[model samples]
Target: MKKFKVSLLQLDVKFGDPEANYSNVEKYIEEAVQDKPDVLVLPEMWNTGYDLERLETIADKDGQRTKTLLTRLAKHFAVNIVGGSVATKEDGKFYNTSYIFDRKGQLISQYQKVHLFGLMSEDDFISAGSTLNQFIIDGIKAAGVICYDIRFPEWERKLMSTGQQILFVSAQWPTKRIEQWKMLLCARAIENQSFVVAVNRVGNAPKDSFNGHSLVIDPLGKILEEGATDVEGIFTCEFDLDDLKAVRGNIPVFDDRRTDLYF
Candidate 1:
């Protein structure tokens, strides 16, 4: 079986502080690279942690800065990157956006969060993405989505419909709803019969607390790696494409779907 190693960097993000957060992320990435994982993952809002009010001034200008840095890192290390979501500024509007890069440092896909957490006033500060995200890395079909987007099974279904075998989620989920975060991730993996690699931030914002439970789950809804709360750590896992195929074949949920009669 062919296996790929993935590293998830679960770190605490300083609220409203991009410089400090960037330095922190850089340090973690350096540490994660020592293991020579095929892909490096980061948590959500790593650039400017939930500082909605200051996003206009603090957000990455069209994500150029993040792309440049990630691209350079990917090329230098010769590894793929699931660059976490950032507060992105474009056309005078802000958005929660994610970027992915290939081992050769090629930009593959970028996803802007579609579902804005109205409870957090995300609707007020960010522009929602209008398209479904699907991309390829090393000939593997993959999809990228933001935090709140995970609640909508239809979105994950759409990605699965496109033959996505791996789902990458980046979130700044609150500690109060940590259980939902974990359950939903497992559900997505089980329902879609795909690998789920989710990275959530740790630490507290002005009004909310985040408990990092970043996890990598296999197709059978088994956790391969999980992170601890209030700490910085690298959780690594090796996934086999053959194993995913075997699990899906055993269950065959996708083949058993009755889509036309449902909706």
Candidate 2:
């Protein structure tokens, strides 16, 4: 299908509490399935919100549990899931990771957050990822990234240049800079000529308060749907791959790039 619907979970995470978060996740996922969107997106660190010190204690072990839950949900609901970023532990180290499950519940993509936000002390607790994640869902090419990656346009362009039509970002952005979150997502969509689907969490953690400003933006920079700050719910939007082609064809941003001049 050239056009499809997506539902975002503007969910809330309990700091250092995976059990509570899991229940919340289940409730939201069940509710989101009611909309029967082709894809479901969620926030970064939804499993444990910025509970850095508790990484070793609370992180998902090798992401097995995360995969199991997402897989079952995707299969049962018949929906693709940009499963969002979660704290995961592997080989005695922790990483912020994002997982994607196809409609069949097959794990399609796994992206560990490459950029660790120094301001949040992420650099101290989590190991950085060195790879990019790009995959196809129902024949549509897409990419997934964590919260801080939005500030780096080159990363988004890297995927868009390689035929990615949709960009999914999952975040646990604090309340202080929610405006920047909205602006950046719109800018990414407009600049890349692709649909940007960003899901953010709401409520508070130990050190920060999250504002749920999850959004879906079209290639022309239009805010298709947005969630309210500090509210928990599902926000859904629909878009067509044809729109990406139209935007790219009209501006030719990629075709007109001066690759030879960049430092």
Candidate 3:
């Protein structure tokens, strides 16, 4: 179906508390499902919010706990899920990973955040991902990326070049740069001619305060839906996935690329 609805969990992540975060996610999912959206998205590090120093103790072991929970929920609700980035430990190294599950609860995509934010000390603890997250959801081609990845237009363009109609971004963007978050998401939509569904966390961590301006933007750079700053809630928006074709056709930016010049 070209028409699809998406719901975002603009959550307030509990610092270093995976158990409490898990319970909160369950509760949020129970409420968000009432909208019956085709896809449900969670914010980055929902399992552990920027609790860097303690990642060794709290990160999900090979993402087992996260995968099990997301799989079960996706199957039970019969909805696609973009299980946002979590701190994961695998083979003694830690990574910021994101998981995507289909309606059948099958794992569709697993991506580790490639660009680590040195400003947040992410570089010191998390190993950068070397791959891209591209997959099909409910017959629609889409991609997923974590917080800092949005800053790199080339990275996003590389994914969009593969014909993905929608880009799903999960983040814990700080309130200090909330304006940049909005501007960047809109720019991504306008430039790539694809829908951008971004979910940012709310509330505060020990070092930063998150302003939940979670957004759903159309290909033409129109803001479909946005959440309030510092308010924890579910935001839902619907759009026609096929509209990207018309937008791209009108501009033909992708077709006019000079691949020979750029390296």
User: What C-alpha lDDT values do all the predictions have?
Assistant: 0.89, 0.90, 0.94
- Local accuracy of candidate 2 as per-residue lDDT tens digits, 1-263: 37789999999899899999988898899999998799999899989888999888899999988899999999999899999988999999999999999999999889999989998999999999989989999899888889999999998888788788899999988899989998999999988888989998999877789889899899989998989878899998887778777678889988888989951
- Which residue pairs in candidate 3 collide? none
The candidates, ranked best first by lDDT, are 3, 2, 1
Candidate 3 ranges beyond 4 A from true positions: none
Q: Give per-residue CA lDDT, model 3, range 1-263, as digits (tens).
A: 37899999999999999999999998999899999999999999999999999998999999999999999999999999999889999999999999999999999999999999999999999999999899999888899899999999999999888788899999999999999999999999999899999999998899999999999999999999998778899999989887877788889988898989872
Candidate 2 displacement at residue 207 in angstroms: 1.5
Per-prediction TM-score, please? 0.97, 0.97, 0.98
Deviation in Å, model 1, residue 260 alpha carbon:
2.0
lDDT, candidate 1, 1-263, per-residue tens: 77888899988999899999888888888899999898998988899888899887899998998998899989999999999889999888898999999998899888889999998899988889898779888888989898999999988998887678899998889999999999999999999999999998888888998888999999889998888877778988888978877887888887788989752
Please give the TM-score that candidate 1 achieves against the real structure: 0.97
Among all candidates shown, the one with the greatest lDDT:
3
Ten-residue segment with the worst summed lDDT in candidate 2?
238-247
Q: Is candidate 1 or candidate 2 better by lDDT?
A: 2
